[model samples]
Target: MSSQLLMIEDDTRLAEMVGEYLGQSGLHVTHRADGKSGLAQLQGPEAGPLPDLVILDLMLPDMDGLEVCRRIRSLQGPAAQVPVLMLTAKGDPMDRIIGLELGADDYLPKPFEPRELLARIRAILRRRTDGGTPAATPALRFGSLEIDRDARTVTVGGQVADLTSYQFDLLVTLAERAGRVLTRDQIMEAVRGRELDAFDRSIDVHMGRIRAAIEADAKNPRRILTVRGVGYVFAKQQD
Candidate 1:
C-alpha cells in the first residue's frame, strides 16, 4: 500500500510540485494551505484516519510551524505518534534542533532538491518500519523506567514518555550500556550507524529531550548523567 502523507504548507506551487514528485515515488500526498486547515484535516472529526506521515512547513499563515508541531504532539493516542518531517526556509541550527525537540522526526531546510526531500522521506519512514521489528535483546527496566527495544517505546513511572524515534534509539543505546560512559560520537554512531559531526550538538539536544520525557526533573536528570568534559552515562542503578 502507498504511504499517505499530509503536507501542511502554504506554497501551493511548491506543494503541488513536491506532491506530484513524491506521488511518483509511491506516496499519496494531501496538501493543506495553512496550519489550521492542516490540523483540521489531520485530526478533525471528518479527517478519517491519520496519515502515515506529515510534512509540515514552518511558515504557516495561521500559526508558526513549531506551534503546530507542539499541538500535534499534544494529541492523544496513535494520532499523536504520527511521524513528522519539518520544512522551513530558516537555516538556523537552533530552529532545526527545536523542531526535533518538539517531536519532528526529521528536518529539512527550504530550497532543497526534490530528490533530497524524497531521500529524507524514505529515511524517516524506513526508521519507523524498521523499529517495529523485534530486537535480539529483551526489554530493559530501570527503576520505574521501561525500555522496549522491539516496540521502540519507553514508559517512565508506568506512563508513556514522549520521544521521537531518534530519541528512543539514543535512550536504548545508553540504557543497554548502563554504567558505561559514551562520548557523543560513540552514542551517535551506535544509534545512527554513522559518525557524528564534531560541530553538531543534535545528540545533546536529543538527550535533553529524552530526559524531559523520562526524568523526574529534567534539569537534574538522574537516569542519564553528564560527565564533565567526557560524555554521558546511564546510571547502573537509579536510587
Candidate 2:
C-alpha cells in the first residue's frame, strides 16, 4: 500500500506538480492550501487515518507554517509522531533552525528541484523505518543512559528523553562509535547520510539539545565530550 502524505502548500501549480510526482512514486498525497485547512485535516475525523508524513510549506494564507508545525507536534500519540519536512522560501538558516527546533524533521529551501525534494522525503521516511536497524550492534548502555537502536529511543535514568528523530539518530551514531572522536562533518554524514553545508551549525545545535536531555549536567557534558580543536567523543561509560 502507498504511504499517505499531507502537503500544506498555497501554490496550486506547485502542489499539483508535487502531488503528481509523489503519486508516481507510490505515495498518496492530500493537499491543503492554507494552515487552517491543514490543521482541520489533521484534527478533524474526516482526515481519515493520520498521514504517514507531512510536507509543510512555511508560508500560508492564514497562518505561519511554524505554528502549524507546532500544532501537528502537539497532537496525541501517533499523530504527534508524524515526520514533517518543511518547505521554506526564506534563505535564512535561522528559519530552518527554528523549524527543526520546533519539531520539523527536515527542511528544503524553496525553488528546489523536484528530485531533491523526493530524495529528502525518502530520506526522512527511510530514517523513520529501518534507519535505526542494520547497525549489527546491540542497544548501548552508559550508566543511567540507554540508547535503544531497535526501539529508536533514548532514556536518561529510566526516564524517556524527548529527542527529535534527528537527535536520536545523532545519539545513535555517536554511541555506536563510543570513544572515537568524530568530526562535525563525519557526524553529519554518518547520521544524515549527507555532508554538512560548511557553515551549517544545526549539527551543534542538535548535539546541545541531546546533551541537555541526556546529560547529568548539560552545561558540563561528560558523555559527549567536545575536543575543542578536533571533534567530539562519546565517553565510554560504565553502567
Candidate 3:
C-alpha cells in the first residue's frame, strides 16, 4: 500500500499545492484545514489507512500545533508511532526546540521548497522504517543504566525511569550504536527521526536533559561524552 500522509494546515492554497505534489510522489495525502476538525479526523473511529506521517502547521484556527502534536502523541496503540513533521513560520531556534521537546519528529521552516520538504519526509520515514540491523547483541551495563532493546526500555538500577518517547529512543540509539561518535546530524536523523537544520542546537539541549536523568553527575556527564567539534560518543562502559 502507498504510504499515507495527513496534513493539518489552515492555508488552503498551500495545502492544495502540497497535497497535489505529494500525491504525485506516490503518497496518499489527506488534508484538513482546521486544528479541531483535523484532530477529530485523526481521532475518529475510522482514521482510514492510518497516516504514515503527519505534516502539521504551527498556527491553527482553534489550537496551536504544539498542542495538537502533544495530543496526537498521547494517543495509544499504533497512533503513537505515526511520525510528525512540524511546519512552522517561526524560525527561532527555541521554537524548533520546543517542537522537538513536544515530540515532533522534525521541523521545517516556512517558504520551504517542495522538493526539500519531500526529501525530509522521505528521510524521516526511512529512518523510522530501516536501520535496525544491530552488529552485536552484547548488552552494555554501566552503573544503574541498562539498555534492553528487546523490551525497548532503560532500567536505571533495576527501576524504570519515566522517559519521554524521544528520550528513550535517543538513549537506545546511542547505546546500541555504542562507542561510535555519532554526529549531531546523525543523531537527529536516527534518534529523533528528522533531518538536521544548519542552526539547530536542540539536539545538544535534549542530550543534556537525558544525561541529567540517567547520569550520576549530569555536569560531568560520563556516559554520553561530547567529542568537541565532531559530535557525541556513548561510552558503553565508563572509564
Candidate 4:
C-alpha cells in the first residue's frame, strides 16, 4: 500500500507541486491550507484512516506551526504518535530545535529539493517499520531505563518515556554501542543513513530531548553523556 501523508501548508502552488510530485512516487498526499483545518482533519471521525506522516509548515495563517506540533503531541491515541516532518522557511536553527523538543520527528528548511524531502520521508517511515535493530535481543536494559526494540518504546522506572521516533532510534543506536563515544556524524549515519551537516546542531537538540524524557536530571544526564570535544556516549552504567 502507498504511504499516506498530510501536508499542512498555506502555499497553494507549493502544495499542489508537492502533492503531484510525491504522488508519482507511490505516496498519497493530502493538503490543507491552514493549521486549524489540518488539525481538525486529524481529530475528526470522518478523517478516515490516520495518515502515516504529517508535513507541516512553520508559518500558518490560523496558528503557529509550533503550537500545532504541541497540540498534535498532546492528542490522545495514535494521532499523537504520528510522525511529523516540519517545514520552515526560516533559517534559524532554533525553530527546528523547538519543533524537535515538541516531538516533531524531523524538519526541513524551505527551498529544499523535492528529492531530499522524499528521502527524509522515507527515512522516517523506515525507522518506524524496521527501527534499524537487527539483533536477536528485542530489548535492552540499563538500570532503571529499558528500551524495547520490537515495541519501539522506552521506559524509565516502569513509566513510559515520551520520545519522538527519531529520538528513539538515536537512543537505540547509542545503546547498541554502549560506552563507545560516537561522533555526531557516526551517530547520525547509524540512525538515519546520512552524515551530519558541519553546523547542524539538531543531533544535540535531540539528545537533550531524549535526556529530558529519560533522565531524572536532564541538565546532569547520567544515561547519555556528552564528551567535551567529540560527540556523545550512552553510559554503560546508569541508575
> Highest TM-score, which number?
4
TM-scores for every predicted model: 0.87, 0.91, 0.77, 0.95
Ranking by TM-score: 4, 2, 1, 3
lDDT of each: 0.86, 0.86, 0.78, 0.92
lDDT tens digits by residue: candidate 2, 70-176: 99888876677788899987577888888888888888998999998888888878777873436555778988888887787888888999787878888988998
Candidate whose lDDT is highest = 4
Which stretches of model 2 miss by more than 4 angstroms? 131-137
As for model 1, its CA RMSD to the true structure in angstroms is 2.4
**Which residue segments of model 3 deviate by more than 4 Å?**
131-173, 185-198, 208-222, 228-230
Better of 1 and 4 by TM-score: 4
Reference-based TM-score, model 4: 0.95
lDDT of 1: 0.86
User: Which tens-of-lDDT digit does each residue in 1-239 have in candidate 4?
Assistant: 89999999999999999999999999999999998889987887547789999999999998989999999999888899999999976578889989988989999999899999999999999989764556666689999999998888999999999998899999999999999999999999988899889999999989999999999999998889999899999999957
Candidate 1 local lDDT, residue 30: 93
Tell me the lDDT of model 1 at 222: 91
lDDT tens digits by residue: candidate 1, 81-190 = 88889996756888888888888877788888999888878877876776454547678999899998777789987898878877887898899999999999899877
